[model samples]
Target: MDKIVLKNMAFYGYHGNLESEKSQGQRFFVDVEIKTDLTKPGQTDVLEDSINYVEVYDMVASIMTGESCNLLEHVGALIADSLYQHFQGIIGLSVAVRKPSVPIAGVLDYVEVVTTRGQI
Candidate 1:
């Protein structure tokens, strides 16, 4: 079980339960881990034998740019689903979406939602 981790991919998007949050938008971070067999790629050193992570990043970026969700959970779930569908080689996946400046008045680093699918 090998894994490819994409961490701290940042984006600016409008996603929140509040109308002001949605209209104003905020910086979001996305982290994703993809589990798959890396034996072939490791042995042959061929790009085709392994997943193209650039494509993965592009896919994530596209999703964030194209859609709007009210909750981090929903965004995370959609990312997990889309990754699973787009990459047949992935046996498992996890996606985490973080909203740093949530409108709550309390002092906190960020709010995050994680979504996982397939055989964890």
Candidate 2:
């Protein structure tokens, strides 16, 4: 199976268990991968024969922008569910959501989550 990967898509949003974290907001990174048959797109080389990743980006962006979910796991699962429900041909998908500059005293680059669905 061929894979399409989206890396480090960033967003600033209100998502956290703590009140301060939610009120202040924080940066989040999202990564996604989709498994598919590449032969059709490779043979025809048509945009329609394959997934338009721009749309995928838009979908994730919309999710981040439109709602406030307290858990990155929920956000990650939403992305995977969206892809799976929207595209039947997609054999499977993985989504990761990361939070950077967390409020805790300890230094950390980010907290990340990865969720996978379907056959891949």
Candidate 3:
């Protein structure tokens, strides 16, 4: 199967378990891999034959910017579920939600939660 990869898409969101996090908001980076047969799209070279990148980005942006979730898991799951519902061609997908600013008292890069759905 072929794949459509959207990596390190950034968005500002107020989602976290901490009240400070919710109030202050933070940057969330999402990586999505949509698995599907790209043979038709590759051969035809038509937009309709392939998944629309803009649409997918918008969907991800909406979820990231909308409503607050206590965990990155929920955010990832929401993105995966929404994409599956809107795009029937998606055989499977994996969503990785990254939180750059964690409240932990340690030095680290970031925290990420990944959610996968369907048969990849």
lDDT winner: 3
Q: What is the lDDT of residue 14 in candidate 1?
A: 86
Model 3 over residues 20-104: C-alpha lDDT tens digits? 9899999999999999999998999998998887899999999999999999988998999999999868999999999989999
Candidate 2, residue 40: Cα displacement in angstroms equals 0.1
Q: Which segments of model 2 are wrong by more than 4 Å?
A: none
Highest-TM-score candidate: 3
Per-model TM against the reference: 0.95, 0.92, 0.96
> Positional deviation of 9 in candidate 1, in angstroms?
0.3
By TM-score, is 2 or 3 better? 3
Candidate 1 structure quality by residue, lDDT tens digits, 1-120: 899999999998888899987788888999999999999999999998998999999988987766678888888888899889988789999998989998888999999998999876
Worst 10 residues of 3 by lDDT: 84-93
Supply every candidate's count of residue pairs whose N, Cα or C atoms clash at under 3 angstroms: 0, 0, 0
Better of 1 and 2 by lDDT: 1
Error of 1 at 53 (Å): 0.5
Q: Can you list the residue pairs that collide in candidate 2? A: none
**RMSD after Cα superposition, model 1:** 1.0
lDDT (CA) per prediction: 0.89, 0.86, 0.93
Off by over 4 Å in 1: none
RMSD of each: 1.0, 1.2, 0.8
Sort the candidates on lDDT, descending order: 3, 1, 2
lDDT of 2 by residue, 1-117 (tens): 899999999888888788887788878889999998888989998989998899899999988776788788888888899888876579888998988877679988778888999
